[model samples]
Target chain A: MLFSFLNKSVHLHGFFETDIYSDMQKPFYVKILLVATLLLGFNAFAQETDNSSAEENGSVKAEIKEFIAHHLLDSHDFTLYTIDEENNEHFGFPLPVILWDNGLKVFSSSKFDHGQAVAEVDGEHYALYHGKIVKTDAQGTINYDEEGHATNVKPLDFSITKNVVFIIVVSLLMIFMFSRMAKTYKGNMIPKGIGRALEPIILYIRDDIAIPNIGEKHYKKYMGYLLTVFFFIWIINLLGLSPLGVNVTNNIAVTFCLAMFTFFITAFTANKNYWKHIFWMPGVPVFMKIVLAPIELLGTLIKPFSLMIRLYANITAGHLILMSILGMMFIFKSWLGSSMSFVLASALSFLELLVAALQAYIFTMLSALYFGMAVEEPEDH
Target chain B: MEKLIEQFSFGLFFWQLLLLIILLVVLRKVAWKPILNAIDERESGIKNALEAAENAKKEMQNVTADSERLLQEARMERDSMIKEAREMKEKIVADAKELAQVEADNMISQAKTAIEGEKKAAVADIKNQVATLSLEIAEKVIKEKFSEEGKQLKLVEEMVSDIKLN
Candidate 1:
């Protein structure tokens, strides 16, 4: 959100082709006073709540947690923020709910009212239970397991949820961007727009990551997958930082799929030597090789597991820390404490940006390394 | 944590897998090929250009060295030719001087022989002329003395005495 505001205001005349050259010359900080007023109002509201009863403080903390949880979860509707305080009213749009309940049920997620009300379609009831649609009646009574797990029957949901929507949007965005970049390379001219930015990264992945890990002869065969994975993770991680509250990469399902893809590619491309080294140590004793063979096989499975967990944990922790610090401004209930929180939050936000790009690099580099290891030729000691 | 794990959906995996595969294929054809090919082409082109330049420079150096050697050989040849011609000229001048001295000596000897012959012949002719004059004088005296026997006897005795003194 800050980036969009900055891009729209101060740094409009950058290498980006957002508004074209005609709108290049524009003054900076047009909305500074407006932002100041908004912050002032928020501070005043925080003070008012501070002076209120202790009961209201508890509810405020609950509201903050609820907001953070909502931000973290994948929702069927796109809610930017809540507008009204009296009744639960969100200031965003709904998405198409694709479900396989009984038959193919298609409807707008606005019927769920941001998971407040239940949606009844064709004499069947559907309720949003913890960001998952489950079959329920009008009362929306949710059944739970002995361990408090939701035992509601869930259909194979193919809904274009907020996360999926962003995925598609981001996918099309990448497609359009790289495809246009490819077109410019037809001649010997430099990339015109985002291509200029992506060129260095592409070369970096090729030189620093792909070529060095995957050898000169075999690196070309795997560049396509490596490049795609790098951009895909990097872009989604960046989008997660935006005000849209997209936590796609922070989700395990997404990370798991990415790791699985890497695993599948590595397994499929592994040469005979890779298996030989894993199952049978050449120089070691035969008994020791047999003992270590299962561990080596387990290592193959663990590699992707660690890859999935690393990305999921890193991004999720970064978001949690950032949001928690921002939530502290209200919890602090004092100007000094709130200001300190604000500073700490700003610093963390900056770190998260770095972490965002770093995680992508780490993931892509490790994937390339694994690919290289798998296809390495057998050599004498 | 359990709740978070519950967020994973099988549908999402399939969807993401399908999407990523499609992305890989499309991007490889569209993006990676052109960018890489252009770089490779430019790189090799530069290498070829540099090699051509280096070869040309070497060839030029060889040609320059060859021309310098040929020029030096020609200069040496001209120097030797001049030296030989100068030596031959000195030899011819010395031989002509020796031949002129021999001719001068022969002419002087011939002139000396002719002068000596003329002097000897002139002396002989003078002696002959003197003998004839003396015989004529004696004959005239004998004729006068026969005409007068006593004067003849006196002249004969004087002639005999003068002859005895000679």
Candidate 2:
């Protein structure tokens, strides 16, 4: 019965592979190419299955799992993981993730099976592996081991999972850049070195962006936020160019956080003039203001939402297109077609890198604009 | 699954809020204030230097104008002194010429008077000599011609003189 099952699996794999290859030749070449590659990969595994014994198959699977676990969870490589020698274990635990509300959430290989090491402290449940706050759970519960050691159950940290390493790296880079700029200012020299490159961009944000939109009087209050947004977006966009497979800014939640910051700042800092224009709107008919009040309030909510969608959609689409093109290589199975696809994909990836920085700049610039509008004093006609 | 999403567990939110507050406070203290202060100081320094330069320029202009006025006054004083000296020299020269002419005229008049007095004296002396000679000659001739008639003529002359006196 086992033999028949293996044979059927092989037959199915071959059938799918053939279908994928045939599809590659169709008019929708790029799509066919991606499907074909995935199908062919399955077929190759099946072919290997025919020659290898069950024991060998089990060992191969074990090796693959071990490779993923060691690299992702144990902090073996520098790209995706950071090792803490003091803790003797990875810092954060990797949780099993299904889907996120805004995007796909998966456990980072950093903290695998670390749900076993959590502890409850003062009525609050915390994943306490090596004395750090690993994850916080909703309800307090202790899952005891066979030896009666208490294991803490907790909800996963979704923030770090999607692209924790990426976020960290980009944030450090931005802090470093801004810190250097501040130091240069203290030294009383026109910022030389890295400061030279960053100065014009900072000035552009202050002059062309913040002052024009926010008005001169209130622009100073929002300068800190505008600067933070500009650098944050720019740094994340730069990281997307690397081969580390980090796409933090592509997630809508990240964009939403940035937009919400702008919203809060504008709302809090708004003068009487801003609220007056929204509720009363000078020189307009009384009926018109009544009609416009709800619309204006709705617009305030929609502005941030639009900012979130625009950044998320552009970055996500760029990554998807690039990945799909790369997948085309295995699909075509023809050297000519695969080579052409690679060239096209590589060119597109380089273009996407430019787009990443551009998108970041656009998002930051737009948020500043919205802030400017919110706090803007009405013109004295 | 929907129930899980709906549950409001304050624990995670509290932690995040705490972290956000901490970040804001720390960043504001460590990074923002010092940087803004430095910029402000630099701007003020530049403004002060520019104002000082403008003040110095004004002072220099005022000094230049003052010196020019002083130089003009000095020049005018020197010109008036030169004019006064020239007029005094002309007056002294004219007085000296008039005194010399008066002395020359006085000497000429004195010499002329002395010469006229001497001529008059000399002519008077000649006339006296001529009268003496003529008287002597007439006495000699009278003595020779009529020694005997002299007593009678003397008497007749005395008689005529007496008649004439009467």
Candidate 3:
């Protein structure tokens, strides 16, 4: 029965299948609540300190929203926790904050003190205002526009922020892991140890994804990209599950860039056949061909756009739901209610784990599918 | 509007692109090609082994068929040889019987002719002996009659009388 359920779930692919296991839902909710309480206790505590208002403690919906927004944004420092509330003492290392302020400004993010202080360097003052660096007085004075928005001179930020740092760390981890996995191939063809784990996924990308979608002729050329993106996304998603909260794929910029890679590859490598079909489709009426051209052109952009949005939205939503459910545990005053909240939230986190890998798979699969479409030769009708 | 613009920052996009491209190039060389090549090698090896097994099976079948055909041919040759030997033996026996019959007939005819010749010679010898014995007996009777020459004058006269009667 369990095997059948699993098979059915696998067949359903992207369908939300947590409901199908209704029998498990009770225990599932309980366990999820337990785990979510523990996890959210850690994460929520860290975030809750950002706005420790005693009067608003009872009604933290507004604070929870603020905490969630802050959690989602990329910051310059890697602040683990605050040492003292009165002193605003933070315990974390600063990453190099690279920026273009008048001229090139390269300094450690320690100058901003985890967005808690204004930084001064070379007779110029910069304030870390709400996660954006802007030119300001030591008092951090800001002039308001007519629209009542802060008008400050902001520099072009290219800092090694928390997210960027994680990206680099993950990249290095990937490189180290794959290099070891690749090294196993020198003496024996069959992989051993880490290679054993790595080989199947590689072949799956090659045989199942790449070779089938992209023809055998072109699959080799595209295999590298497919493998790279799949592992890159998969590893990043896995990292998101950790306490470090490495939500690289959740960032629109990252997803956009990844989709852009697919888009560019498809555009550059596309044969004459792909363009011909899009521009003046064969076997269709002349009027229909003319009408279809613009839509087809828009479709080119839409494909990558959807790719970007789908990954970003899915990851972001998964995190949002988990955090919200976790926040509900604090809202429930009763032990029973709070326990139930924790359990349900915990269950959702488990689902998020699946969603993380799934989102990665979907993104890679869609990208491959698009690549396949682009390089497809016209069938003789 | 400004928040949205910050999310779509050119700097982040550019960095991300640079990082991703570097990752692709690195992984393609370090990870993908080796792993993919190994898998391909293993698959092709398995295919080659299966093909070799199929060839061996086919060869075994051919060998069996050839041997079976050869065995049948040998059996047929042995059967024909046995039949010819039996026929030659029967013909030899018949020829010997016919020759024995002819020799037996010739011996019987020669034996019969010898017996006939021996019987004729024996009869001729007995006849010669009988002729001598009768002459001897006649001479003895005439001698005894003539010895009595004194009485012959009287007998001669009687004989002359008898000859006149005859």
Candidate whose lDDT is highest: 1
- Residue B150, candidate 3: Cα error in Å is 12
Q: Give DockQ per model, in order.
A: 0.24, 0.05, 0.28
Candidate 1: which docking quality band?
Answer: acceptable
Better of 1 and 3 by DockQ: 3
Tell me the tens digit of each residue's lDDT in model 2 across B69-103: 99999999999999998999999999999998999
TM-score of chain A of each: 0.84, 0.62, 0.82
Query: To one decimal place, how large is model 2's interface RMSD in Å?
Result: 9.4
- Which pairs of residues collide in model 3? A32-A343, A32-A346, A32-A347, A33-A342, A33-A343
Q: Write the per-residue lDDT of candidate 1 for residues A1-381, one digit (tens) a residue.
A: 223333333332232224311122122112323433456655666667566645765677677766766677778888887888569887989999988877899999999988888999888889998888998877888999998887888888888887787778777887888888888777765677787888889989989999999889899888888888898898999889887768888777889989998899999999999899889967899998998788678778777766787787688768866776687677656686678779988898889889989999989998998899889988612
lDDT of each: 0.79, 0.59, 0.77
- TM-score, candidate 1, is 0.76
Q: Residues A230-308, candidate 3: write the lDDT tens digits.
A: 8888888878877777577777788889999999999999989989978988889999999888877777877776777
Considering just the first chain, candidate 2 attains a TM-score of 0.62
Task: Give TM-scores for every candidate, taking all chains together and pairing residue i with residue i.
Answer: 0.76, 0.59, 0.79
- Restricted to chain B, the TM-score per model reads 0.53, 0.52, 0.61
| Error at A281, model 3, angstroms | 3.4
> Which residue runs of candidate 2 sit more than 4 Å off their true CA positions?
A1-159, A187-189, A324-354, A379-381, B1-25, B47-166
